[model samples]
Target: MKPSFFSQYWCMVSQGWKADLADKERLITPLLFAITVLLLFNFCFEEVSKGIEGQVFTAELYLTTLFALQMSYVRIFVPDQQDKVFSLLQSYPLNYSAWFLSKYTLALLYSLLVFVPVMLLCGLFFSGADLNIWSAELWLGGLLSIIGLSTLGILLSTLTLKASGREMLFPLLYFPLAVPVLLASVQASLSFLTSVPGGWHWMGILAGFDIIYFTLGVLLFGELVTAV
Candidate 1:
C-alpha cells in the first residue's frame, strides 16, 4: 500500500531527525555544553541561594532554557549549510513548508530532550529547585520560541550560504533577530518558576512570533532554495 502524503512527510521528518541525532559529534557537543552550563550555574549559585532562597535557581533555569534554544538554532541550521545538504534537499518533491516545518519540529524535539533531563539534573543538584510548573502553557511557549528561533536561523543560514564568512555572519545575523524570542521566553520562564500570575502574555508573544516567522520562512524559503 502506498503511503499517504502526510505519512510520507512524517516519515521524511522522522528520518531527518534521526540523521541529526546520529551525528554523534555534533549531537554530543551540544549536550555536553548544555550540561556544563547547567553545572556552572549550579556552582555559581550555590552560595547565592542562601540569600535569594530560590530565585538564583530560578534564574539559572531560565538562562539554561535561553542558552539551549540559542544553541539549537546553530545546531539546526549551521551544519546543514556547512555540509551543503539543504541545497540537495531542494531536489526532492517535498513541500517547502513541510520541509521547513520538519526541520523546526526536529529542533524543537531535540531541544526538549536536552532541556528536560538537564533541568531534572539541576533540580537534583539544587535542593530548592522546583520543577513542578511544567504546565501546558510553558511547554507551548517553549515550543513556539524554538519554532521562531529555528525559522530565523534557517532564514539567516539561507542568506549566508554564499557569503565568504558564514561562521561570523551567522551569529551576527541570528542573535539580533532572536532578541524578542529570548526576551519573551525568559519572561515566560520566570513566571513559571515563580508561580506568578499573568505570564501568558509572553507566551502569546512567542506564539505570535512563531506564526509571523513561520509564514515568512515558508514564503521566502522556496525562492531562497531555488536560488541556491
Candidate 2:
C-alpha cells in the first residue's frame, strides 16, 4: 500500500530538516551575509537625516532579505541532487504535489529562519526607542511576502535544476520575477511602520502572488522533475 500524502510529506520534510541540520553552513552562510550587509549599510548611513533614515532602512531590510532568500533557494534541491535521491524518488509512484509541498515548506521555514533574526536586528538598529516594530501588521506583511517568494523560489529552482550555468541563470530569472513580491513587501512594510492606511492592499497583492505561484508549482513541478 502507498503511504498517504500527509505521511509522505512529513517524511520528506523530516529528511529535508535533517539534511539542513547536518550542513549547518547552508543556513548560516546566508544569515551571516545578511547581517554583514546590514552592518555595512548601518555604518554608511548612520549620519543620514532621521527622516530619510527610515526609508533607507526599510529598503535595506527588504533588499537584505531578498538577497539572503535567493542564496538559500539554490539549496532547496542540492541535498537531493547530491545524494541521487531524486532518482530514487522518481522510481516510486509518489505524489509530486506532496514533494512540492515538502520542498515549499522547507523553503518557507528556511526563509523564516533567515528573516526573523534579521528583522529583530533591523528594528534594533533603525527603530526609535519609542517605536514598536513587531506589530501584527508587520508580521502579516513579512509572512505573506515570504510565502509568495518561497513558492516562486521552489518553482524556479525546479525549472533550473538541470540547466547549464544555472548558477548564472537563477538570479537572472529570479530577481525579475520576484520584483512584484519584493515591491509589495517593501510597501506593506512601510505602511505598517508608518501607521499609514492601505497596508492591507499590499498584503493582498502578496497573497495573490502566493496563490498564483503555488498553483503553478503544483501543476508544473512533476512534469519538470520527470523531464530531468
Candidate 3:
C-alpha cells in the first residue's frame, strides 16, 4: 500500500530541508536578493515623504517577494530531477496532492524568510509612513499574497522544467501571471493607511487568487510531472 499523504509529505519536506542544508547558498540567495532590491529602492528615493515612502516600500516588499520566490521555484524539484531520481520516484504509488502540498509548503517557508525581515527593515527606516507595520491586516495580506505567488511559482516551474532556456522562459511566464496577485498585495497593504474596509477587500482578492492558483496546481502538477 502507498504511504499516507501526511507520511509522504513529511518525507518530501524532510528531503527538501536536507537539500537546503547541503546548499546553503541556495537558501541564502533569495534573502540577499530581496534586501539588495529594497536597498536600491531606498537610495533612489531618499528624499520622498513618509506617505509616498510607505506606498513605495509596500509595493517594493511584494515585488521583492515575487522575485525572491522566482529564485526559489527554480530549485523546488532539483534534488529529484537530478540523477534520474525523479523517474524512480514517479514509479511509486505516491499521492500527487501531497507532492504539490510539500512543494508549496517549502516555497511558502522560503518566501516568509525572505519577506518578513525585509518588511521589518522597511518599517524601521520609514516609521513615519503611518502604515502600522504590525497591523493584522498587513500580515494577513502578505501571507495571502505569498500563497498565491508560491502556487503560481510551483506550477510555472514545472511547466518550464524540460523546456530550453527555462531561466529566460520562467520570468516571461511568471511576471505576467503574477502581476494581478502582486497588485492586490500592494493595494491590500497600502489600503491599510487609507481605509480599513478597503484593506479587507484587497485581502479577499488576494485570497481568491490563492485559491485559483492552488486548485490549478493540485489538478495539473501530476500531469505536468509525468508528461513526456
Candidate 4:
C-alpha cells in the first residue's frame, strides 16, 4: 500500500534536507551571490543614494534579495535532476507539494541568513537612512517578502522542470510573474525605512502573493513534476 500523503510529505522533506546537508557547498552559491549583489548595488546606486535620502541602503537590502533569490533559485532543483533522484522519487507515491515546500524552505533559510545581517548593517551605518533595523516588523516583512519570492520561484521552477534552456526561460517566466512580490517588497521596505503609514498594506499584499502562489503550488505541483 502507498504511504499517506502527510507521511510522504515528511519523507520528501527529510530526504531533501538530508541531501542538502551532504552537499553543503551548494549553499555557497546563494550566499556569495547575495553578497555580490548587495555590494554591486551599493556601488551602482551610489549617485542615486545621494538623492533617495539614504533610503538607498534599504532599497539595496530588499530589492537585491528579490533578484538574487530568483537568480540562485534556478539551481534549486538541478542537483535532484543531475543525480536522477527525482526519477527514483517518481517510483514512490510522493506528493509534489512536499517537494515544493522542501526546496522553498532551504532556499529561504540561506537567503535570510545572508541578506538580513548585511541589510541590518547597512541600515545602521548608511548615512541619512533612519530605520529601526532591529524592529520585529522589519524582520517579519523581510521574511514575508522572501517567502513570497520563493513561492513564485518554485512555481516557475516547476514550469521549467523539463525545459532545455531553463536558465534562459526561468527569468523570462519568473520576472513577470514575480512583479507583485517585487513591487510590494520594495514598497514595504521603503515604508519601514521612512516610517510611512502604509507599510502594513504592502506587507499584506506580499503575504497575499505568498498565499496565492503557495496555493497554486499545492494544486498544480503534481502535474508540473509529472510532466514529460
TM-score versus the correct structure, for each prediction: 0.79, 0.96, 0.95, 0.87
Highest TM-score scorer? 2
Residue pairs in collision within model 2: none
Q: Which pairs of residues collide in candidate 3?
A: none
Candidates ranked, most accurate by TM-score first: 2, 3, 4, 1
TM-score of 4: 0.87
Better of 1 and 2 by TM-score: 2
Q: For each candidate, how many residue pairs have backbone atoms clashing (under 3 Å)?
A: 0, 0, 0, 0
Per-residue lDDT of candidate 1, residues 1-228 (tens digit): 644557656976787777766776666666677788988876765555444544565566556765665565665655455567766767667676666667666766767776677656766776554544556665665566667877787777677767777768777887788888877876876676667766788888888888888788889987776786
Candidate 4 residues 37-64, lDDT tens each? 7777667666553447526666677666
Worst 10 residues of 1 by lDDT: 49-58
Candidate with better lDDT, 1 vs 4: 4
C-alpha lDDT of candidate 3 relative to the true structure: 0.84
Best by lDDT: 2
Better of 2 and 4 by TM-score: 2
Clashes of 3: 0
What order do you get sorting by lDDT, best first?
2, 3, 4, 1
lDDT of each: 0.69, 0.87, 0.84, 0.73
**Sequence-dependent TM-score of model 1:** 0.79
Span of 10 residues, lowest total lDDT, candidate 4: 45-54
